[model samples]
Target: MDNSNGMAKELAGFLIKHYTEQLHSIILSPDPRLHYPLLVDFAELLDDNPTLAHLLFSHPAEYLLVFDEAAIWAQKVIFKDLKQWDNASVKDYVHVRINVSGSPLECPETFPSIGRVRVKHRGILLTLKGTVIRSGAIKMIEGEKIYECRNCKHRFKVYPEVETRNVIPKPTICPSQSSKFCESTRFNLIEDNKICHDYQEIKIQENAQVLGVGAIPRSIPVILKDDLVDTVKAGDDVIVTGVLTAKWSPDVKDVRCDLDPVLVANYVRRMNEVKSGIDIPDDVIMKFKQFWLDFKNAPLKGRNAILRGICPQVFGLFTVKLAVALTLIGGVQHVDASGTKVRGESHLLLVGDPGTGKSQFLKFAAKLSNRSVITTGLGSTSAGLTVTAVKDGGEWMLEAGALVLADGGLCCIDEFDSMRGHDRATIHEAMEQQTISVAKAGLVTTLSTRTSVFGATNPKGQYDPDESLSVNTTLSGPLLSRFDIVLVLLDKKNPEWDAVVSSHILAEGEKENDNCNEDLKSTWPFPMLRRYIHFVKRNFRPVLSKEAENVISRYFQLQRRSATQNAARTTVRMLESLIRLAQAHARLMFRNEVTRLDAITAILCIESSMTTSAIVDSVGNALHSNFAENPDEEYAKQEMLILQKLCIIDEFPDLKSNLQ
Candidate 1:
C-alpha cells in the first residue's frame, strides 16, 4: 500500500490474469458496444487477495486510482501484445469500477441502512441500498489537465482534488528544470489536455418496510461519474457501493453553510425485482408445504388459515382479506403481438365508513409487502402520486412519487376519497398500464410503476346500493373501472353481526397472548406470511387452462349481454381483469395452471365488487362474510347456481340479471 507504483503494477497483473476472457471479448470482438470503467467484482477480488481487498475498504480513493491506472495499463499491454489495435483511441476507454456484492455487507447485520450511517462511518467503504427517488442531470467535469506556468514557462500535470472537484491548486514556485530562480505563481491552463467524465446526481430513500414501524425513511444524495451516469433512473431500487464523504455546501445569503454528507458511488447495481433481497429458507418452504399437505383435501381451509394472519386484529372480513392476498400475489404479465405489455398487477379499493378497519388493512398490507409506501390521500398531490419535477441547485430533477418508488411491490393510499379528483385521476394510468408518463419542466420520460395499489376510501354519505361507485365515492367511472376489485366495507348496524363481533373481541382479550406465534398452533405469523407471499409471487406464474378460459369467457359474455347502465363498465378491461384475477388465484393455490376453481373465485371476487349484474343480486355483503366449514362446497354450489342462472337468463331475457 505504501508503494503506489508497485501497487498499481500488482493490480494490473491481477486484472490481466483474472479478466482475460472478458477483456478479450470487449477489446478484440467486433461488437461496437464500448465498455467503459470495466466492472470487477469485489467478491472476486476478495477471494483472490484478502489483504488488498480489505485495504480497499479503508483506502478506496487511493486504490481506486491505482485500479483505474492499472486497467488502462493492462489494456495498452493487451492491444500491443495481441496486435489487435486499429485506432489508438480504443485504449483510452478502460477504467476500473468495483461492484460490491457477496460479502458481510449483504448480511442483515452489516447491511448499511441510509438512516443508520453515522459520522464514524465516513471514508469507509460501504454498500447502501435504497430506492432512487430523484435523479439529477448528467454533466461533464474536468478530470485531469496539464498547466503551463506563465512566468517560468514550466509545464506540469494537475489533477482535481478528490474532496473539492473542479479545482486545480496552483504551485507557489515553478520547477522549470535548471531555472530554480523562476518563482512564478501564474499558470496557463491547457483546456484541450483535460480529461472529462460524465457526471450525474441521484437521491435515494430507505425502504419503509425495512425500517420497521414508525421510523421515518431517510434520503441521501449520491454522486455518479463516468459510466455510472444515466445507468439508473428515478424509481430504481439500487445498491450503491462507495466511500461515504462530506461535500461543502454552497454559500447562501443569511444562512449558515455546513458540509452535507453524500455518497460517491463506486458501483451502482439495480435490483430488477423488488423483493430480491428477501431470503426464504428451505425449512420455511418445507413448513409451508407441510401446512398445505395437512389440508390437501381442504386446500381452501389452508388458504384461509394464511388469510387469517392478514390484519388479524380486524374481525371477519373474508372477502377483503382474499382480495388482499390475490392483489399481493399478482398475475403473470405478458406482452402481446403489438409489443404492448399487459400489466398483471391488480389494484384494490376498500370503500368503508366509520371504523370498519380500512386503515388497519392498509397498514397491514404494507407490512406484507417487501417494498411499500404509505401516504394519506388528504394532502397527496399528483406529484406525489406519480413523478414530480423539482428545481434543485438550478436544475430540473425528477423526484419519484409513491407509485414510482413502490415499483414492483405495493402502494397503500389511505383516505382515498379525501384526495382531489385531479390527484385520483393521475393514477389511472399507473393502476392499469403500470407506468407514469411525465412531461414537465422540459423533462419527458416514462417511469414504470408496476405496483398493486391498495386504497381505502369512504363512500359519500350513507352507502347506496343503487348508485354507481363513481357517484358514491366521488371518483369518475373511468377511474373506478381501472381498479380490478373494489370491496365496499360498509359498517351496517346489524344486531347479530355486532353480537358475534363483540363476543369475538371479548374472547380475544381473554385469551393470553404471551405465547402467540405464527402457528399458535395453526395460523401463520407475520414473517411466515410475508415469506409465503414473496415466495409465491416469485415462483408462480400461472397460465389460463381451457376450463378457466371457458368459465371466464362465459362470465364476460354474460356481463356484456346484460341490459344495464353498468354495461359500459364491462368493456375489454373487465375481461382482462377476469384473466388477471384468475391467474392470481391459481398462484395463491400454488399451481401453474389456472383451473375452474380459480376462475370461479375470480368471478366471486369480481361479483363482490359489482353494483348490478345479470344473474344474482344477493351475493351477500363482503364485510359479514366469514370462513365456512366447507368453503369448497359453498363455492361449488355458488358456481353451479351461477351456471344454471345464466341458462335461465338465456331462456328469458327479462330477468334483469344482477349478480350482487
Candidate 2:
C-alpha cells in the first residue's frame, strides 16, 4: 500500500506538471470539462512497478479516490512552480481531470465480440462493433448527494459509489447522534455541483450478414455518459470501447432474475457512407482484367452473359434483364463547379404479367446489392419509406426508414402500383433531389437518400395488343417519367417461345434432381461482382466522346420532332437518360470513353421501349413518326360522315312518301 501510494503521488506530480505547461492558455477557457491526457506509457510503468500499473488500469476510480489529496497538493505546487518560470496566472484552486488511452497491445482485457460477453466479463473493458437500432433520451445523473438531518439539523455529504442499483444510499444515523434514521424520505437532500453526468442509452444489434439467413440477430443495451452521449444515432454502424456492467432489477424480490448487461462506453467510432467493405484479392483483380479483355473483344456476347448472370431463372425477358444490369452498374454522378449535382444512379420500372418473374428479379437485385432494402408497396407508408418521428423515453426521436437506411445503395419496392397515392408521392423528392426532409415534432432536418430505386408492378388491365399501353397500366405519366427505363413484359401466346421456356424450366428441374449445381451458379459470384462494381464506381469515371455526344444530340432532336401526342415525346430528362445509359454501357466494358456504339445501343433500347408501349392503329401498324396527335380524331370523322348520310336519307324519305 505504501509503495502504491508513493507511485500514485509521483504520477500525479508528473501529470500536474504536464498540464500546467500544456493547458496554461486554455485553463480559463469556457469549457470546464476539458480533460488533459497524462501521456504516460503504461508498458514503462508496468516494467518499473507492476502494482501501480495494475491499480491504475484496473481500478482507476479507486486510485483517484485514494490519492485525491496528494494530487491536489501536486497541482498547487505546479501552479507556483509555473509562475516562477513563465508567469502563468490562474485560479488558485481548480480541479484538474486526466485521461489515459493506452495502446491496444497493452490492453489485453479488450474483448472483441459482444457474443462472447458473459457474467465473468463484467467490470472488464471490452470492444464491440454493431449497428445502432434504437436510442433513448439523454438525462442527467447525480454522482453525489448531500442530506440534512431533520431532528438534529446536521448536514453531511455522501459520494455515491458506482453500482448497478438505482436507489440512493442514505446515512444510517445523524452525525450528531441524535436519533436512528428511519427512512430516506425523512432527510432533506441537497444537490452537489461537481457530481453530475449526462447519460443516454442505445441498443445495438449484430450485423445482419454476420448472422446467417433465418437466424435472429441479437442486441445489447449500452450506456453512454458525459461526452459520449448523443455521439451516435440509429442506422449507424459503430465500434464502441467500454466496460461491461450488470444492471439489476429494481425490485428486491427479483434478485434471482437474470441481470441485464450494459456497456458503459468510453469511446465510439462511427462507420457510415461506406458501402461494401470487401477487400478484393489480387486474384479477383486478375480475373476481372481477363473478363474485361474478353468483353472488349466481343461486347454483345459479354453483355448478354453478364445480364444472364444477374438473374438466370427469369426466362425470356432479355430487355428487362439488360435494363436492370445497366441500373446496377449505374453512371458517374457529378457535382459541377457551381455545386449542382447530377445523379448517376438510374431508376427502372417493370410492369408485367402476374407470372412473369418480376418479383423474382426484384428479390435477386436486392440480395445482390451491398446495401439494399426490399419492401413491398402495400406494406409501406409515407413515413415508413422516408422518416418518422417517434416518442422514445418521452422525447421525440427521429427514426430513419428504408430509403434513408439504404442511402448510397439500392431500394427495391415491389408491387409499386399497390401503394397509396400519397405514400407513393413521398418518394418524388427522394428520387429527384436525392434527399428526404422531415419537419415533425419541432425537428426539421434533411437526410440524404442517394439511392437507386428499382420497382416492379403488375398490369392493371388485361393485355390486348389493340389497346394503348398507358390504358393497361395504372401508373400516371409523372410517375412513369421518373423511371429512366420502363420495360413492358407481356405473356404473349407464342407456341415456339412457350415451348422453349417450358423446356428450359424442365431442364432446370432435372438439373436439381441430378445435383448438377454448375447450371444454377452465377458466372460471376455475387460477392465478387459486388466488389467489382464497388471498385469501378470508386475508381472509374466515364466521359462522353464527341461522336457519342453528336449521336445522342441528333437522336434527341429527331425524336422530339417526330413525336406526336399519342407517342411520348423525348424530353430533356430523356436526353439525360440516354447519356446515362451510354455511360453505363461504357462502364460495363471498363472503358473510360463513351463510344458512338454505346449511344446507338441506348437509342435502340429507347426505341424498343417506346414501340412496345405506344398506341397502334386498327391495321396493326405502329404510328412511328406519323403518330396522330389525337387518338379519337378518326372516330370523330366517322361519326360526322354517318350524320351526313342520315341527313341525306331524311331528304330521300320526302321523295319516297309520294311513291308509297
Candidate 3:
C-alpha cells in the first residue's frame, strides 16, 4: 500500500482498462445488484484520472456506502431467518416501501411505484441510486404505526400501530394474497406482562404472507466519505436483499453488501452525460416546424407541451445538460456544478402551471444534464439556494447553493410561486442579467449564476378571462416577462374528449401503440431539438437584418400603441423576450442574421400571449369601472338610481356591473 509500491496506480489503471473495454458494450442487466461492483471499479480506476475523479467525487474523505436494494433485501433475509419475521421486532424494523395508493387506479394491473426511503441525518451527502422516496411518506410513518394498504384497502397490524391501536396481528405465511401495511407507517416495540404468547392476539389471515419481503436482492457496500457530506444529509442510492423491514419512525435502514460501487458509477455517469451533435433529418425538422406552427395558432391552455412531443425537447432546453453539451464542445475540464462558470446566454427559465409536466420534465432534464441539477421549492429561501457563508478550513468560506451546484448546467425549480417574495425578487437580475449579487457576512461578491432555470407554478385560483393578473395570482409581471418563450398551456376542453386523451396518454405507455409514430411526428424530436440548440450555439454571432429589424420595430410599435402612454416601456420587456426567442430561432437555422421568418415567428408567439392579456385587461377594466365607484351607501344608492334610469340596473347587480 506504500506510495512507492505503485499499487494504487496499478489498481487504478486496471480498473480504467477494464471499464474502457466495457464502455462500448451494453450491460443489459437492469439489476443494481449486478451493477455495483462495476461502479466501484470505475471509481477506483478514476484515481489515476484525477480529472475524472474530481468530476465524480466532490470530496475525498470518508464515504458511507449504502444500497437501497441491499437494505431491503437484508431486512427480508433477516426477517426470514428470525423465528418471527412478522413479530413486534420485525414490525418495528425500519425500511423503504412502495406507495401503491393513487398509482393503482391509473395502472390497475401493476402496482404504482411509490418512491424511496430516506434516513434522517444531518450532514451534506451525495447519493447514486434509484429514485427517492416521497417525504410525506416518511412524516406519516414517523407519526403512526399500523396503516391500511392504500392500494388494496387492506388493514394489517404492526408494532407502531400495536402501541396506538387495540390489537396486534399474529404473523402468517402464504405465497399469494400477502398481508400489507402503509409503506410510511412506523412503530415502536413493546412487551406486555399481562398477556402471554397467545392471549387474545389477532392473527394474520390464513395462508397470507408479507408483501415484497422475499423479492429484494442482496446488498453491496461502497466507500462513504465524510468531507463530501452537506449540512443537510440527503439520501443515498443502494441495492437491498433480504426480509423487508416493517416501516419504522425516522425511517433510517442499514443495507448489507453483495455488489460493489464500480458498476453502478459507470452506468450512472454514462447515462448522465450530455449527448451532442444529434443529427436529425431535415424532413423531421420540417414536420416539427409545421406542427409547431399549427399548434401556435390554436395553442390551448394548461398543456401546450403535450399538444405533441414538444415536452421532451422543451424539457431539454432547461436542463444543465444543455450547458454541459455546450461546455464539452468548448473543451473545458475540471468542471464545477456551480452556475457561475457559464456566461449570460446560457440561463433558461420555464414558468407554468400544474400538470404541465413541468416537474416531471425538470427531473428528467436534470438527470441528463452534465452539470448537476440542484432543486428547491419556493418555500426555500434565497440564502438556502444560492451563496452562504460556512466554516471551511477553520475560516468562513462562501458555500455555493443550488445555482452554484448547477453552475455549468441548470437549476430546475418547482412551486416557484410558493417562494418568498424577497427570494423570488433576488433572482430577477440573475435571470435577465445572468449574475447573482450577494451581500452578506461582510462579503459582497457577484457570483456568475449563469444557470438555466426551469420553473413551474400554478395559475391563480381560477383562470380569468379578463383581469390584470396580480403578482399574488401568479409570478410578478417582471419575472413572467423574462422567459425567452412564454409558452402558454391551453389544451382544448371537452367532456367527450377525455376518453381520447386518456387513450393517447395510456398509448404513450405502450411500445406497440399505433399513434406513437404520429405522436413523434407532431413535434420536434429530442435529437432534432438538441441539434437545433447545438447549431445555434455554434453560430453565436448574430446580426439583425434590415427586414427583420423593421418587422421587430413594427411589432414593438404596435405593442406600444396597445400600452398606455405611461406604460410604453412595459412592452419593451415583451420585445426583449421576442428578440431572445428570435435569436434562438436564428441560431437554430445556423444563420448569423435574424431573418424575417424568425422575427415573424417571435411576433406570432408574443401576439398570442398579448391577445390573451389584452382580453383580461379589457374585461377587468370594464368590471372595475362599473362597480368600483359606489362604496358608500349614499353613493351606492345614487348609482343604483342612475343605473335604473339608464336601464342598466338589474336584479343581479354584480353581473350587471361586470357587464357594464
Task: Give the runs in model 1 whose Cα sits over 4 Å from its true position.
Answer: 29-35, 41-51, 76-81, 84-90, 104-112, 116-119, 148-155, 161-165, 169-192, 212-215, 250-256, 282-294, 511-519, 563-568, 648-660
Tens digits of per-residue lDDT, candidate 3, 321-408, equal 2222222222111123774332334333333345545566566555544344445565468866666665421334454556644554
Query: Runs in model 3 with CA error above 4 Å?
Result: 1-309, 312-353, 364-376, 392-394, 471-474, 490-492, 496-500, 509-513, 521-532, 564-571, 611-660
Give the Å error, residue 218, model 2: 5.9
User: What residue pairs clash in candidate 2, if any at all?
Assistant: none
Task: Evaluate model 1: give its TM-score.
Answer: 0.88
For candidate 1, list the clashing residue pairs, or say none: 518-525, 613-657, 613-658, 613-659, 614-657, 614-658, 615-658, 616-658, 616-659
Which lDDT values do the candidates have, in the order given? 0.80, 0.65, 0.39
lDDT (tens digit, per residue) of candidate 2 on 1-660: 465567658766655644455445433334445322222344555655576657655655455444444444555555554655444444322332322234442243454556656777666545677777666778887756788878666776666443544345776766553356434335777654456767788878776556667876677888876667787876677777666777664444535655678776656767674445557788987887888687665566665556656667655466666677778778888886999898888888877777777888888888777777788898789887888888743578676777877777789999998899899888988987798888989877788888899998887877564544456666666666667887667676667767866777877767565433664553566676677776666667899998678767766776676665324325677888888888888887677899766776666556545633222221221111121234234333432332233233233344345335
Off by over 4 Å in 2: 1-129, 134-203, 206-221, 226-231, 243-262, 273-275, 464-471, 511-522, 562-570, 611-660
Candidates in order, TM-scores: namely 0.88, 0.69, 0.44
Worst lDDT run of 10 residues, candidate 1, spans 651-660
Q: Between 1 and 2, whose TM-score is larger? A: 1
Arranged by TM-score with the best first, the candidates are 1, 2, 3
Reference-based lDDT, residue 380, model 2: 87
